[model samples]
Target: EAYAKALRGRTSDHPVALPHPDVTSQDPLSKGLGLMERMAEGFALAMDDDFNSREAIAKVLGGVREATRLLD
Candidate 1:
């Protein structure tokens, strides 16, 4: 939400704009951190004592690793 707002514009009404810390970064680590954060959210939301949930979390982790490697 904040990211989208930053991408659009910032003002009293918008309250976010370009050149924001999250929007201005061109660094792999920064981007990777964002991805990791999202993955963590998904993991938390999907948590359960079930095989499918565990498998899904594993897949998300794998994707994060692959993305990090590509960003590298």
Candidate 2:
């Protein structure tokens, strides 16, 4: 939600502005980031479904740690 809003509001003038690629563009980085976003969204939804489940929380945290490692 926040990310989608930020992307929508971005302008070419911004220092780190992304290229306004066509909708059909097969950009690998974009696709990878999109997949990550989906993974995060799924984690959020799962947490909502079972917030008190220790197993679910641990899995999501492990995923987040892995993602942080990849980013680093």
Model-by-model lDDT, in order? Answer: 0.58, 0.57
**Mind giving the per-residue lDDT tens digits that candidate 2 earns over 39-62?**
566667767885746655666676
6 Cα displacement, candidate 2 (Å): 18
Considering every candidate listed, which one attains the maximal lDDT?
A: 1
What does the lDDT come to for candidate 2?
0.57
lDDT of model 1 at position 39: 65
Q: Relative to the unseen true structure, what is the C-alpha lDDT of residue 46 in candidate 2, on a scale of 0 to 100?
A: 68
